[model samples]
Structures are given as structure tokens and as C-alpha cells.
Target: MLLNQLIKELITKMGDDELIIGHRNSEWTGLGPIMEEDIAFSSMAQDKIGHSWALYRILHEELGGEDPDQFAFMRSEKEFKCCHLTEMPIGSYDFSLMRHFLFDHAETVRYNSMLQSSFLPLQQLARKVRGELKYHTLHADAWIIQLCRAGEESYLKMQTALDNCFQLACGIFEAGPDDKLLADEKVYPGEEALYGQWIENIYPVLVKASLNVPERKEPVYGGRYGKHTAYLQPLLNEMGEVFRLNPEATW
Candidate 1:
């Protein structure tokens, strides 16, 4: 495929993934592990949802009147472009924290790469997104510490979540031809590089928490190429329920 087509595909897929993940995560509002984290996670979820909204708008207004919600909510499971990471069940607090750590780490890297995008809109959006995640990561790190220090059980659970989920987490970086184009064009760094950097930064945090970092494995594939986990359908079902019931109803 041509580079431009690939770029467009990459953006669209990434957008849909964020839209659903953000929406799902946001559902945890007021239901999180603690009050502060509840608020913080919801805030982060809003950031993602806001970013998704922008991506959807860009897809519709800038690209064409594409059915952003349909692509997001009503698409077939295979049609979904989200990675296995975001679609996984939100586990216990420790598990969620582990997921948060993995996710925020990759997103930080993705935003950094996107910061250099040649496309002005993409570059600007990425820069803005990067700026927002700082607090989230900080909160996650703090929680990791508190949880790890709180008890052996918390630490062990966090370790398991980290081990079980990190592979899928890494899949978030499975780049495509568009990734190549962006890297070659100096618009973005390769995902492998980003993933490596995350390991470097996050490894010590896990070590300090006495949380066992899972032996990194070959990524479990299927983010950039649009293959989602089995869990995505149910989430989308709930997400689209309201809209499906009344496609024409105003919010």
C-alpha cells in the first residue's frame, strides 16, 4: 500500500482503539480502588476519550463523513484495530495498576514518536497528549509503591498482572508499513525503540517495588494490524448499546 494510505489506516485504527479503551476505562469512575485513584483514572480516561473524540472528528471532518462511532462501537471483532492489551478485563487494583503502568508507558513513547510527525495536526495532537499523561504516570508510580509496600499480596498480584499482561502490552507497539514510512521519513521513531525505552525506564520501578517483572516475551501481536482480543466484542456491545438503541437520539 502507498505510504499515505498506510498513514491514514494507522491513524484510523489507533483512533478506534483509543475510543473504545477510553470509554471502557471511564466506566470505572467512582468505582476505582480508592477515591484519589478513582478520580485520577477517570481523569486519564477522559483524556483518552477526549483524544479519541478529536481523532474521530478528524476522521469525520478532515477525512470525510465517516461513521466514527460505527467503526468504534459496531465493527466486527476482527475489524477492531485495538491491541490485546486494552481489551483485556480490568482486573483487581494491582492488576489495573499493572495495566496502567504498561499502557501509560507505551502511550508516553507513542506520543513522543508522534511529537515528531511531519503531519502538523498529528504532531500537534501528540505533543498535547504527551503533556497530559505526566500526572497519570506519577500517580501510577505512587500507587505501585504504596501497594507494594502495603503487603506481599499486593506486590505478588501486581507482579502477576505485570507478567500476564506485559506481552499484550508490548503488542501495542507492533508497527506496520505506515510505521516504517513514518520512521524513514523521520516523522516517528520505530515502535521497537519505544518499547525498549519503556523497559529501561519501567524496569527499575518494578524492581524497587520488589514486583517481579515478567520475562519479556515476543509480543502477542495484533494492534496495528486490527486483530483485537475476544474480550473486545462484549465491551463494544455495552458501548454501542445506547447508540444502537437510538441511533438518531440526541444525547
Candidate 2:
């Protein structure tokens, strides 16, 4: 495929992931475990959602006229291209922390690769995203290490969170069929290869944190191809109910 076609495909998929995950993270406002963490979570959530809005705007105007919020809140779960990782709930400090840990690492790798992409538009978007990603990773890393070094209970909890979430971790690396074209265009790395790098980047953090990684099945891909986890439906229902109810209502 031509490089522009490939970069266009890849950017669209990447935009979907960023948008949905950002929406999910925004749910953390006022819901975090404590005051400090609450501020932190909300701050990061805002950043992510802002990034999503920017990316989605590109997808909306340039790619097609898909409204950002509607494309986000109205789509069926199966139509959603987001990975399983973002679909999961914000559970305990452990679960949420693990969630952040996994995603931050993946985003770090994902953005860094795109920063050097051959696709001009993609490279520009990636450079903007790169502004916040390193800070996110550093924050997640500190929390993971802190939790791990605290003791057996913290370690166990972190382990459980990691074990449960790692399956979805692979989803970040599972692009749709157009993935190869995107890589060939240098818009982004392919899913399987990017995932290999994610493992290498994440493993040391887990090891230093004193947490044991779990055995997991091979990735069940399809999100980018329109398949979704069970969790996405309810989320969509809620996100869209009001939109549907008041499609023409001015508020």
C-alpha cells in the first residue's frame, strides 16, 4: 500500500485507542483513593482526554466529519477500536495503578516510535503526544515500585492487578489488518513488534517492583477490527443514552 494510505489507516486506529482510553480515564475525577492521588489522577485524565480530543479532531475533519464526542460516546462497543485495557474498571489503587503502569509504558513506546515516523501528519501528532507521555511513565513507575517495596500485601495486590490486566496489554499491540501497511509507511510500528518492545520496557519495572508476571493466553485481537470486550457495551449505553435522548437539545 502507499505510505499515505498506510499512515492514514494507522493514525485513525491510533486515534480511536487514545480517544476511548482518555474517556475512560476521565471517570477518575473525584473518585481516586485519596486527595493527592485524586488530583494526580484527574490531572492525568484531563491530559489524556485532551490529547484524545486533539487526535480525534484530526480524524474528524481530515479523515471524515465524525464528531469527536459522538464518535466516542455513541458508537457500539463492537464498533469501538479500543483495547481491553481501557475497558476495564478503575478498581482499587492497585488495579488503577497497574492499569496506568501498563498503558503509560505502551504509550511511551507507541509515541516514541511515531515521533520519528515518516508520515508527516502522524509524526506531528506523535510529537505533541510525546510532550506528556514521559511524565506519565515516570509517575506510573514510581507508584509501581513504591507499592511493591511496601510489603507482601501490596506486592500481592499489584501482582493480581498485573496478572488480570496483562491479557489486555497485548491488545495495544494488536492492530487491524492494515497494520502492516502503516508500519511500511513508517507511521507506526506493527502490533506484534511494538508489543515485543512493550514487554521489554515493562518487564524491568515488574521485576524491580518484586512482582511476578503471570502466564497468559496469546492475544485475542479484533478490537481494531470492531470486536470488543463485554465491558464496552454498558459503558457505551451510558455514554450514549443522553446523547440519543437529546440529539437536538441545546444545553
Candidate 3:
């Protein structure tokens, strides 16, 4: 692919992940196990959505893409590049927490790698996103460790959650066709490198939490190329309903 096309694909994938996961996070608004968790997830959802908007803005202003709102809210499910992990329903609190732990750490690794991107706009966004993701990973890490150490039952549940989420989480690193091009141009590190870094970054935390990382798991892929679970279309419908009802109406 052309460099410009490659960069657009890369950022669009990043932005789609943020947007979809932001909506998934928002689903916990009133459903968290505790008041504090409710607030924390809600706040994180806002941050994720804001990050998506910023990415879309870069696409619009720098790469000649569509409006942020249109890009986020009007796209069909197949048009989105978010991973299937983001598309899955937020299951039990254990599942949600584990997913958060895995996903946010992956986000941390990706953004950190982008800190020196040849794409100046992405590099600037990475600098700003890095600080916010610190607290996100911190929150996830603390909870994982705390829950795992709480009791045998809690520990078992956490371990199970980790096992269940591991493959899906691996999908988060699914490579774009142009990933090598991006890496060669120093636009960003390729997915393979980011996957390696993500493993290193999360292994210590998993050990500290007493959770075992599942071995030899096959990654679920295809989301980067628009294939998704059945869950995603319903989510897209609900998320876009209001915007579609009045696309011309001012917020």
C-alpha cells in the first residue's frame, strides 16, 4: 500500500479500537460491582472516547478523512477495524476486569512505541495518551493483584478470566497488511514487535497477580480487516441510533 494509505489504515484501526471499547466500557456506567468501579469505568470510557475523537480529528485534518462523529457513529460494523475482543460483551466482573487489564496494557505498549513516530501528529497524540493510560494500567494492575490475592476462589476466578481472555487479547495485536511498511517508515513499530513488548510488559504483572498466562493459545484475528463477532452489529446499532436519528441536529 502507499505510505499515506498505510498510515490511514493504521490510525483508523487504532481509532476504531478506542471507539468500540469506549462504548463497551460505557456499558458499565451503572453496572459495576461497586460505586467506585462504576465511576472509574465511566471515567475511563470518557477518556477512550476522547482519544478516539482526537484520532479521528487527525485523520480529518491531516489525512483528509471523514468527520469524527460520522466516522465513529455512522460506520457499518464491517467498516470498523476494532478487534473482536472489543466487540465481545462485557461478561462477569472478573471477565471485564481481566479484559481491561490485558487490553489497557496492550494500549500502553502501542502508544509508547508510537512516541517517536515519523507521523508527527500520531507522535503528539501518543505523548498525550501515554499519561492517561498510566492510570488505566495502574487501576487494572492493582485490581488484578488484589483480587487474585483475596482468596482461593477469587484467585481461581481471576486465573480463569485470564485464561478465557488471553486468546482474545492476543487478537489485539493482529497485524495490518501494511504493518511492515509502517515499521520500515518509522511510522510505528510493527505488530509483532508490539506483541513481544506487550508480553514482556504484562508477564511480570501476571506473575505478581498470581495469574497464569495461557500457553500456546491461537489468536483470533480478522477484525482488522472488518470481520467481527455477531455482538458488534447490535452494538453499532445502539451506539448510532441517536446520531442516525438526527445527523444534522446539533449536539
Top of the candidates by TM-score: 3
lDDT, candidates in the order shown: 0.74, 0.76, 0.92
Ordered list by lDDT, greatest first: 3, 2, 1
Displacement of residue 196 (Cα, Å) in model 3 is 0.4
Task: State which candidate, 1 or 3, has the greater TM-score.
Answer: 3
Those runs of model 2 whose alpha carbons end farther than 4 Å from true positions after fitting are: 1-9, 248-251
Show model 3 residue runs off by greater than 4 Å: none
lDDT of 3 by residue, 121-209 (tens): 99999999898999999999999999999999999999999988999999999987678888999998899999999999999999998
How far does residue 199 in candidate 1 sit from its true spot (Å)? Answer: 1.6
Q: Write the per-residue lDDT of candidate 1 for residues 137-201, one digit (tens) a residue.
A: 78778888778888777767777777788888878777775566767876567777788888887
- Per-residue lDDT tens digits for candidate 2, residues 1-251, read 36545554565566666666666776877877778888887788878777777767777776664787777666666666677787777667788888898988988888788778776665787788776888888989999999888888888888899887888777777756677776775667787777888889988988898788766587656776777777778877876787898666766
TM-score of predicted structure 1: 0.90
- Once all C-alphas are superposed, what RMSD does model 3 give against the true structure? 1.0
Task: Select the stronger candidate by lDDT from 1 and 3.
Answer: 3
Clash pairs detected, candidate 1: none
lDDT of 1 at 24: 64
Q: Pick by lDDT: which candidate is best?
A: 3
